[model samples]
Target chain A: MESERSVVIAPEALDDLIGALRRRGFRVLGPTVRDGAIVYDELDSASELPIGVTDRQEPGSYRLEERDDEARFGYAVGPHSWKRFLFPPRITLWRAKAENGGRKIEEEPPNETQLAFIGVRSCELSAIAIQDRVFIGGKFVDRDYAARRDGAFLLAVNCGEPGANCFCASMDAGPRVRDPYDLALTEMLDGEHRFLVEVGSERGADVLAELPSVPASQSDVASALAVTNDAAARMTKAMPQVDLHALLAGSLEHPRWDDVASRCLSCTNCTLVCPTCFCSSVEDTSDLAGVETARERVWDSCFSLDYSYIHGGSIRASSRSRYRQWLTHKLGTWVDQFGTAGCVGCGRCITWCPVGIDITEEVAALSKQEEKSHAATA
Target chain B: MATATPSELHPVGAFVPLPFRVAERRQDTGDTWTLTLEPEESGFAVEPGQFAMVHVFGVGEVPISVSGPPERPGDPIVLTVRAVGAVSGAICASELGALLGLRGPCGNSWPIAEATAGDVVVVAGGIGLAPLRPVVLHTLAQRDSYGAVSVLYGARTPADLLYTDQLEEWRSTIAVDVTVDAAEPPWKGKVGVVPKLVATAEFRPEAVTAFVCGPEVMMHFTVQALRERGVPDERIMLSLERDMRCGIGLCGHCQLGPTLVCRDGPVYSQADVGALLGVREL
Candidate 1:
């Protein structure tokens, strides 16, 4: 690998980077204000980015408002992540039509289109890596996810302001980017509005050659580092430092599960917002004439009672079992299965939860029970 | 390791089903039938205890175990399906010469090699016997290699029993015993749960490696009976049933605790999964 290089670019020149990527046949996708919050979509220029906008996020709450300072990428993550683009919500697996003497099965090819994602946060990058373990890291890779992932280019943005519900620092994922990216930009607005760009790959260097930028000075790098450090200190929530995998696994019958289950609506909002949740179910539908059939895979959540259904009845009958399964699987057994924790600590699940149920609080409750049990033994 | 073998495991991109012709169909019970399928093209290989995702044209796909012996040069793959649900009912209703789609031989199987030098015991209840048919045939074919072979089968009633001729034929070489839960007159056999037959079966607890397939409740009781008789947990094997969506680890439908019953197992030793089975609503 080549040594890293840095550059200084004014806020207006950011459009030139977008133009360079578009010239190279990349459909650049960036965050834009939509439906009361910033969501990712196709972007033609930097004007489409959520500039001068910040989000107010808390447990079971998310709202966007205007900001006095015009800082690009000022907000934390929204409800959606990049998973929607890689692993689509619904995919057509195959189609079968009644042929001459027998029905012929036809396979549907995967979407191998090229894409470039802009303004990816550190937590989102960790989420993508976790999903890669589930879909692409195994012996049998998911062809659709692998193709899309292999063809895409990532543009990371280091966070300067951690949102109210953000806890990526505790998860060891956030406030700063660590994953491999084509290019990384840290927006520094301390008296001077300029971005400290770090070229992470050869592709990033090639694109940097096309843009008009000056070599960043040592002070510029210091300013960028300070911005991320302040953001980490400002994080409102902190995940408890405990052996989460062991604690949750042993707390299967803990009473705190019942308390949270009563408040949970099982609407699946938390799973839908979670960047790493990848459970899906297949649906086979026939045409009105009943000559052709289509098999499709669609996203499904564990909160649904039918997700674990068998022939006679559903395996997880109560909301209590379902919630317990989700939390334990995401935080506990996931480490054993995938060699990593499922949650990226993006706090999207907390902000998007309708009933304000916080995973951090639930984990803390379980940890407290364990401490009491240990004390009794002592 | 009930997970698929390297050769039989297909990447997700190969989700397309292949058309196979139903060469023969035999009805064993009112709601159950055994269908023998010949793939339109050759080169299809399926291992014993493995299953296939069988698709009926307009209905849907359901995971059915390959009931036949390991594929021979020109033999067909056999599947014993019972009409327990809508998808299975449609599959059982298909006529001969009809074409159905198949996509598997996925998941792991019973360890036949381990039983070669030791006592081989097989327990099948109701339709669960379909998956274990291969193990029985394989052990009997190499009867001289194993110490002793015993097959204990049970069904709801005498009429509900499957493979009558095969059972009688197997008795000539292997120890085959049949029982019914509620039998009607003239029929004189044991009338109790399937695990009770384990007491009368000829095998030493130290040398026996049992293979079981049945309802979850029956497997639980049978495993208990085996453990009480001093059979180690690792030597006792059983196949589990769940709502398997994707016959791979991608879909989370068939997960039981830390194990993905599709990829990690449908077959597991009692020592490996005894604690997992104890967890409620897992």
Candidate 2:
């Protein structure tokens, strides 16, 4: 069924697609080479993409190297996810001023940027969907996130290069593009540099109608499927097949938490790089005369000492407790809160952790301990 | 690229606070003050155990429980705040006629409606009495609707006790037993933890609905006392406190296990949060 809607476009026509989006008033953002990493940034043309670049990622490591062939979207995800754009780092919530011996409050205007994201990975799409539930699916919605997300265009790219740390297959989140995208592209690098683009929405069909392209051949569709299949086959890491929520719930008192705490740093690197972490804190700032004031929301992490602060002191003060909170919340209680796991298995948390603490490794240890306890009880 | 109409945007007034003028202010203690605020435009209706996000313009916002009876349109909203942090301190120092921002009546309310036929036991410690004040007032207004009603209250010292005059007034209608952790030589009353007083209170333990609120440690001990006295866990209601920023549950600061305390509860039965309370630093 997908083969009928799929079309083929040459490598040069990628620039035309960007032009069409920009002409339609979208601020196109895509992957680009910056500061020795492939980070998402504003792109005026396809020339700005990380051409001939591939990234090698492992726990506590990321390195960009040249690929043997020119595959534009060859690399797995980098440090930046689309979260920083949809849910910005800092935003003014409202402003207040002293007016005529009384206080007058003013709300910040709704965001109006129509974003067009390029090179979005499948795991990232799941992350976006998870955040959508967090922000908009609840009883109270975040109007700002809704504004940016509703008007944005998502261009998904099927994965052909799974990072060493990526375990999206185990989480059932990626390696193959899914719904909630405008257009899904599978970059084919065999013999000819072309793309098999499948239209996921009407807007995608409209854009494809404008671009110079041909209906995808059977061979082209097969090549695209083979690309994702090979990528999935190449994945080396996977989350152990167990009920993660029950595992963490039963293993809360396991001694592995203390062992992991000895090596875990509460540096908040994993949360910042994660695509679905949405915790935040707000700040109220005032002018010198104390007449004008504004409140701004900023990203916050559970690993921070002040994140769980009450009147007397921090709740999760110990490194063991903080790490336990992050892991348990992401893997265990998040399912209970949002009806899905908070983690996408994108491996950003693993690749960016300075201490090289791996989530899958920790879970495996906890699972082993749980089995031992059950064995003794039996 | 198309512009979204206003209708397409979800009405998100959750973060915006409504203006309320401080109509009356009374210092309950040296550190605690109760402010009765009249809404400038619309009314702020709240249930018994619900709370409000009170804002002092330039300082910050903090969640304070409504301490007065349920109000109608144009009625005043009441909040009792203690100067424990910078935001509460600013709210405590606000003068009369000062305009403050309020964003609540957020979170689930106590199951007062479900306790009609059952005896009600209200246990409060220190400033925790503020949130439970409405429950007492509501039960007293319809005095004949239930069996024996009791109020067990405790504070750090006599000087830290809130609503002293009302406590004396309520004694004539219901069993009001007050205790302090410590007192001077002149003070003659029960001088022990509030949980100890819970055992001596007169009520049918099997048929009583217990509402307990205080510091976490105090509430834990009170729950133990109630359980020991044969009160069921589901009937033991508790109001919990956590660091809250956005009272609407978006900020993710008030999570206790799977529940966002700001959204799912400021109030929960002992059966709901018992395991959560047992876990240290959860």
Candidate 3:
């Protein structure tokens, strides 16, 4: 492991580096500026990248801004995530062609995957962790996710420019990549935009050997640290730290909920943007001739009314209850079961919330008011 | 929908539609239909409150609780189904002894061993009683294991009451309290809902653990009443009813937030449902 070290890639020859990756049978995917926002998509060359692009994000709002510097690792999360590439929203679980009255079952052929994700933030890695628990951790693993996860590799980029909506620093997920990556890149794009690449696994080191990268000097390491430390300290968005699980579980009857519920659109944008939210609906498709039938699982949300339907009625029939369920489970009770906070505190819920309902703010308010009431009683 | 070729049994998570013949159909009320299925293979083993995916090959599959007993685990698994959607409607419309597909006796059931006969309260509202029927049967069979048994049931109206025959038998043999939302002209039973009756009914709170299954509104009210009566959230248990399409905990249709209703529960206490209780649409 000590022999596995960092390599410094020159900024001028970034395209040559991308070519090296392509030659090694890696379909390099990364953040590219598209439709006024930085989107994660397939990048064939360095020219397709978000070279001089940045982004602006707030609670329920997002905007893109171009940077004067020709740096690539200058943004946080955008509309596109690695989930689309790995766990697609819709994939053929199985397909059948109906023949005669009885439907014949056939094997669904598996597809090959050779993706190499670039610039995955730490929080996104954590998100991948959550997804792994769902798809791979269970007894019946999703074979498709398994093949994709195993075949594809990662190129985790350290966050040099944090978006306004970014809360990876607060969530303890990033500003850097820590786990589940092949190569973790510290984009020391300050003064001179060069990459400090750390090979996490054997595959990463093998990829590094192909690129024209130099052994990093002490100053290069220090320069990379300085860039990362600055961004970690400069994270703009935060939710206050309260015992999230306890606070949420205790405040079942808290009246502040009504105030928040009034503004929540129940549009499910928070969940859609959320990398950890994995709820899906099952659909059975029959052929036009009405012989063969196929069943599929598609992404579903708690916000939908039909999700809770039983005999004649739906259990959770109101928006308020749905919001309460999503937030409480994400922050509170999830700890008791999954042994971790369901939320990585990405601030996507805060920013993508059409109502600007910040979870951290709510927990803080609850704590403050409870303290006040207790003092009054005392 | 990319569907697999319909195989006899699927791979570990493969969707296998187990075609069974509905040998018997019993209508306890105008709304609820109970079917006894005879699958080609035996060993349709399940516990009380666990559910099975009843499929109409052309229509779709819906999750209905296994209200049958463990005594006859291999014979035929009984499903007390209520008409709701296209698939359920198809099953209801189909003749007795009609061919149907079954997938599972999925999810955990009520831990009957946890409840002693000291004093057990079985509360059901409308068709919610169907899921609890197996527990009732199991408890009745093992009469000496329990102390005193009482079943409290509430329905929309006299005409809406389900399992009328079974309720009559339980009334004669066990301590039973049946109520309706509104009493009819000839109705001599309790007029109020189940919660109002349960709050006043005396039972041993120390030794008693309640099994309450009902509409979401009724269960909430019933649970609140139980908690107010000094029963711990853990003691006062309720089975949730959700839109279960796969019934195998895969489809998010049965999820109440992160808790898979088909897996973690259809049975939850106030402690479990509290997070989910706030979200009405969940």
Candidate 4:
């Protein structure tokens, strides 16, 4: 086991870390400015990061703004998550071709590359852990996901500023780095513009031994803790927790569902942006020659009416039922199925929703309705 | 972490469909056909009430119940498909010697051990009878273990009724009563809904275990009538139908509230899923 070690690295030495990972043959991915928002993509040097930039995010709104100081990691989650790279939106499971009056089936060739993710927030790390439960920890392990996960490396960042929609503190998933990462870094720009690096795993210590860094002083560690605690105190949003599982489960018939459904467009933006949503659909298509076929699995959202379609008609014909299913399944029944809440409180669902349907607000409204019903019953 | 169980019985991922040679295909009604498929490899057996995701070559795939017995492990897997949709229609049009893709023997099975000690009543409606045909066959094969077995079925018309020959052959050992919603001039038989036949059947409510399958509306009424007869909720089982794409729990298409019908059940006791059945658009 590798003992915990902390060090102080100047802002300029960040390039050495990127170079070290590249030397290790890892395709390093980090946040960069693209399409007027920060998106994760290939980063060859630390200069590619969104330097001196912060993002303003609200329900159904996101915009990049220039910060007074150079904060390399100041944004919350973007529209895309790490799920796109891990459990890709589309993957071919197998292929088949016509043979002598029969068919010959072949397993899909395994495809995975060595990956190292940089600028990963604590909430996103929790989201990754949630997906780990679904794809790898379930009764039947997803072979494709297991292969990619085995060859991946993670470098997590502590959140020094929480977004307006973020509630990771309430979910107990963020504002502080708790889970194991290859390397953890906390940016301290208040007095000295330097990063406090904490080595977590053996791989993290190996990389730290290569970089030139001095031992972190007591003040550096204390300042890093202050940064995370300040972010936790700054968050304005929170999830209501008055028997939330039972509240959502029993409130299936609550009239507030109709109100939310009326505002919802059912465009499937939430599920697409959600980090922990794991529902998918399979499609089998053949070539124009009519001899070859390929079965592919793609990400699917419960908001679609066709998601529940059978021989007769759609099971959830109304948008009200669909929205209710999405909410209760995420916050309530997910605990029953996976032994954890489906949400990691990254706030991507709220920030990317088209009609500004905030989950925190909706859960609070439902909790209030349950309280009123309880009072009346009493 | 440890890898999953051995690969022979359980594959790493449960999505791949293997090829099964269609040894024989017989049309029972105008739109319904039964295909007995011999797998290229042996050791794949299917129990009653389980289903298979049958791929129709270039078209697509649909879930059809295995309406065959599991008495022998190497016996051909049998499926009865009704050509109501595009994929099933393509399946019904396939040749006898052609090869189709098959995935499972997936989902839960009927509780034969419990039903054997009590009186069994099998109720079905229209094409919904396809999944229950195996239950009827299993009960008769083990007739000595059960008491006063009965089968009550209903169809839209005489032309829509499936497995008439087998239904007639089973009459010597068990009480088989069938009805139709409408009939032609020369037809002389019972003409009403399926639940009405349940009222006229001879079985002790306290000692009976009923299995019902059919269209959603028909199943709703059949469960209501069975409850009125004083059959306890747990004693009545129903095989449900949904848009099961993956035929596994991974796909969220078949979820009904907390239950994934593909995994938790296509066969659920009325007591387990009764409250959810009548909930509108749930």
Error of 3 at A199 (Å): 1.1
lDDT for A313 (candidate 2): 95
A best-first ranking of the candidates according to their lDDT comes to 2, 1, 4, 3
Record all residue pairs in model 1 with backbone atoms less than 3 Å apart, i.e. clashing: B2-B108
DockQ for each numbered candidate: 0.41, 0.63, 0.29, 0.48
Question: Candidate 1 chain B — worst ten consecutive residues by lDDT sum?
Answer: B1-10
lDDT of 3 by residue, B189-208 (tens): 88988998777665777778
Which run of 10 residues does model 2 chain B get worst, by summed lDDT? Answer: B1-10
RMSD of each: 3.8, 1.2, 4.6, 2.6
- Give a tens-digit lDDT track for model 2, residues A201-318: 8888888788999999999999999999999999999999899999988877789999999998899999999999999999999999989999989999998999999988988889
Interface RMSD of 3: 6.4
Query: How well does chain B match by TM-score in each candidate?
Result: 0.93, 0.97, 0.91, 0.94
Candidate 1, residues A203-302, lDDT tens digits: the string is: 8888888888888888888899898999999997878999898898799889998999999999999988899999988889999987889999889999
Residues B120-221, model 4: lDDT tens digits: 999999887888888888888899999889999999999988999988999999999999999987779889999888887878899999999998888889
lDDT of 1 at A101: 73
Tell me the chain A TM-score of model 2: 0.99
Candidate number with greatest TM-score: 2
lDDT of 3 by residue, A258-285 (tens): 7777888888888777877777776778
lDDT of every model, 2 decimals: 0.86, 0.91, 0.74, 0.85
lDDT digits (tens) for residues B141-181 of candidate 1: 88888888999988999899999999999999999988888
Q: How do all models score by TM-score?
A: 0.96, 0.98, 0.85, 0.96
Whose TM-score is higher: candidate 2's or candidate 3's?
A: 2
